[model samples]
Target: MSTPLDIASLIDRERIRPFQWTIFLLCFATTLFDGFDTQAIAYTGPAIVAAFNLAPGDLAPILIAGTLGMTIGAMTLGLVGDRVGRRPALLGGVALFSIASLATAFASGTSQILVLRFIAGLGMGGCTPVLLALAAEYGPARHRGAIMTGVLLGLPAGAMLGGLLAARMMPVIGWEGVFVIGGAAPLALLVLLWFALPESLHFLVTRAGNDQHAVRHVLARIVTWPLADDARFAVHEAAARASVAALFREGNARNTVAIWAVYFFNWIAWFMFLSWLPTVLKASGLPAAQAPLGTVVVNAVFIVCAIPLSIALPRISTRRLLIALLALGIAIAIGLAYAETSWGLVFTLAGAAGLGIGGQQIALNYLVVGAYPTTLRATATGWAIGMGRVGAIAGSAVGGTFLNMGGPGGFYLTLAVPLAAALLAVIAIRTNEPEAGTSLATAAH
Candidate 1:
């Protein structure tokens, strides 16, 4: 008689293997480049404006194009991952962005830049949810939250790298050189992914065209076991077809709506701060050269704190932690409005706020990925991130208006509204338990 093996149990039971680490690292690298390219336009924005002799508002279309593309890509390509495969979807997205970034270097007009950026956004946006799903699937349940957050940390790290490279390389080779490097690095990574990146074992088994041979090969590497030709593999989760409506079925409706709400409002506050903080800092008496440091401090603090936060995620309730983080952000936003013009005070407050908002964003990823079955993981994560991208667009669009109406104090005060709403949404989530080691199969049913 052939022996039956549960794929989820096999992954959960094994010690962390080198193969799994490789997957995590690759996913991390992908996100790192994703961040770099995503922010490439921002880093190059001034250069583009100067190069083209364009009006101030002319760049808005170029900026918004990429984000708009990302929103659509996340919602649609995420479904592609569910139906086709993670490996292919990821490869395709990387290819799309790489080519787009490379092409951006050759653009002659603002129109060309706008279209190329939108195309690049599609790839970057699609990759986020798929990579998250891929990394989470490979990770052992005990360490899943840490692995996902670790991968996500690359976004900020890459953004920081883009800033450094833009400062250094633009001086040497000019702005076009920045895009050239961004496009080339990922093209190199694409070759490695083709050779080394494996399709998700869970995806292989659960997908309609089950590829048992591929599953056995990947399983052997992870488990280091010899398997019989007659051996059978299965996932313990309840059957779920990959579809948008499936997100609302199977008792998932409440969690889905709440997760979407949290993502939407949290990003509204986040992008608002990211978009306008430098201007706000400058207006509050800081020099233009030093103003950008406030944003850097925020990202750096979050990157540093991510380590301990990841450690604590498995031990505590993600829901409660997220709520606390949002509350902290709310308080900090209010405090920021009343803070003195001292640079030290402003940077300090910004860092503290980054800890709260940035930490909450990662915790939301941990919560959402664990809430769905293997079949719907990519789709669910994709849609939530897509919704967040929409919120980002909204925040970025309205930030100028807020600054005009309220100045620094008003801008900061307005930020608190979104954080408060996000806190309420998180509080409404009914699944309050730590998701580690729990079978989502049972939870879904």
Candidate 2:
């Protein structure tokens, strides 16, 4: 008695639903937690120093501990996220970071807090790359660019939240309360995920060898489940037989290295700016009290630019877009060397830097999802990020050293080197996807 239209509606109700909003919320909450976790350490730095009667030198180990832990986490969990399922990998990351953060609240000594923060850093590292992979999987083809940007911008938003929280409550709650807040938020998210967060259908289909029930549920929520052949999907027909080694064969090797290079340089430059920017500002004549506010300006522009930047990306070629943005970033950083006391001039140059960096980040997220099969998606993304973490550590350390030696020119020049490499990497990089496309991940309901 049912017409084809009726059958189509039924399929939509049960299969291949566009995953636009569902994926967005899933990623938004996770990115918020990411921002909160990363910023907590800086916010707590002062209180910890005072409480422990610590010298600035004494704090270096604590900072290094987290970076070391994060490096390990990125490599280990990242590999696992690729081998296992992204959903489980992501959940595991959240759990590890959340528990580690909570553990910090109870620590009575610097040594104890160092271990806890390191543990949290590992988890934080695991989350970002894996989460990026997951966001790409659930999102619609056209919407991938915007969704990734929307989700990643949450990181800056989270950082801002930590700053606001510290400003308001550090007096009352101190460092312990700040970490408790960061730790507890994800615990709440874990519950919400259990009830509503669905496994990414793309991951299920490509990585888990397909499940009609899950795939259908996710799809049906969209206008209807797709009833297409295997070719419509990027998943290989031979994927069941394909190991990750397949990605390294002649067809994919150059692409892999280029991607890795891009990630490494990108993070080095990014962390250099983030870790050193305020210090650089202070040296440029801003009061110490006001120097930290420069981060607010940088991140504010970054978060604001994310939406428009991402919306624009899908329309352009990925390689072209990424290389162009990185180039612009390099130019802006050079310009900052000349920007002294002109607040308006400085902010404009700073925002230009944010624009370039923000665009590059969004493009990277897009590449993480679309460039590989769902099975290796998390792993590839994770490894790239892990390399970046290493660069961040080096960048932070070197930026500090540079600041000590000279001034703004010295600081900005240090960042310029890595960024130049990133630009070159972008040029060499090629994705499996064609030049350009669009997607706005959607659900039928």
Candidate 3:
């Protein structure tokens, strides 16, 4: 009788292969486009305001609409990923966003823009957690943290790229052209994903109803050893039924709740900064032409720090690292509250804030992906992100309100509260180390 082969151990024991790198690159590309489209509206906000003859504050509803859709998408498609497969769920998300973004180019008014952005958000929200799940599963156990972080870097990189493109493209092609580019790139990427993306091997073996032959074929590509026709395959990790409830099972409840809290509070500060910083900078006497660059600074700094942080994650304590990063964000928020409105001072603070906020966001995502088993990974990550999107909705709305009520000082000061809460939430989490695929037997006991 053939013995059962553990899929996770099989990957851990092998050298990194080209097949894995291809998956990483594909995931990176998907996230890159997701970032571009997600932030496209922000970059194009001023132009949209001008085009529609609307007040700056009117953008809040549009922002909220998108995030609300993202919340729904994250929760819904995340479950879909667990039920069907990560590849199909990811592809569906990309297709949804691509089509929505293309439609945004032709939008005639705020209502239409709101609708299009919401639809685009659905795709954005849905694909993100699934992509992270796929990337983490494909990555080796020893380097999973770094690999996941590298894949996630595409988000900020894409956003930074959007900022650069918007600065140049908006001048020549207008906001419509920016949307057109945003929509088109992902549509092209969608085609590539449909053809090139592979299903997660973890999912193939662990999930019911998958073809055994297909699993063997994928396994053969990753490993040099030949598999017998009757060789049994398994993922040693605890299996949960394909449902959201699985997130709370197998000693995951507290970790799940804490993760959601961290995501919720962190995103309140994160999206508030992302959604309003450009406009806030403009209001604080920065040039209209340069306001969007503030966001670029944040994302650029984030991209710069990602690799080093990723490299450090496995070597350090994740909980302590997360808490320290949140503390840094709190400090930056306080600094921003008192800093003068000069571009030099504000931009300097923005970069520092990126280090704190961006680092925490990436690390938290890494933690979530690593904390749960393969069965619950996508759902847990998605729900956490979905909760964060809800916070993002609040952040967008609160940003406008705060700006109108007390200006930049009040807005920046308020951010510190959420960062502090997130710090506490991080402290509350019980599972802070990389799980690296705990065995079912180990987990149960």
lDDT by residue for model 3 over 1-445, one digit each (tens)? Answer: 7788888788878878898898999999999989888888888887787788876678889989888888788778978998888999999999999999999999988999999989988999888879987887776676775676677788898898888887766778888988899989998988888888888776787685655677787778788888887987877665444588877888988888889999999999999889888777766777666667887999999888877776676556678888889999999999898885766778898998888876777576567645776667656765787788778889877887787777878888989998999998888887646554432112211
lDDT of candidate 1 over 92-126, digit per residue (tens): 99999999999999888889988999999999989
Model 2: per-residue lDDT, tens digit, 1-445? 2221322233324433445566668778988987788767655665666689864335556666777777777677757876777778888888888999988989989999889878888888778767776776655444555566678788888876776676667678877897898999998997776667766555666577756556655555664435444312234232333454655875667767878888888887887676556556656876544444555666788888777766665565667778778888888878787776887887677767777755576677556555665555545665666677787777655665676666777777667778889888777766655334443232100
**Alpha-carbon shift of residue 245 in model 2 (angstroms):** 8.2
The prediction achieving the highest TM-score against the true structure is 3
Order the numbered candidates by TM-score, best leading.
3, 1, 2
Model 3 stretches astray by more than 4 angstroms: 202-208, 229-232, 241-262, 314-323, 365-386, 421-445
Could you tell which candidate, 1 or 3, scores higher by lDDT?
3
Instruction: Provide the overall lDDT of each model, using Cα atoms, as 2-decimal numbers.
Output: 0.79, 0.69, 0.81
- C-alpha lDDT (0 to 100) for residue 226 of candidate 2: 57
**Residue 194 lDDT (model 2):** 64
Worst 10 residues of 1 by lDDT: 436-445
Q: What is the lDDT of candidate 2?
A: 0.69
Off by over 4 Å in 2: 1-23, 43-60, 78-88, 133-137, 168-173, 199-259, 278-292, 317-324, 335-348, 364-386, 407-409, 424-433, 438-445
**Candidate 1: Cα lDDT at 77:** 78
Q: Worst lDDT window (10 residues) for model 3?
A: 436-445
- Error in Å for residue 50 of model 1: 4.4
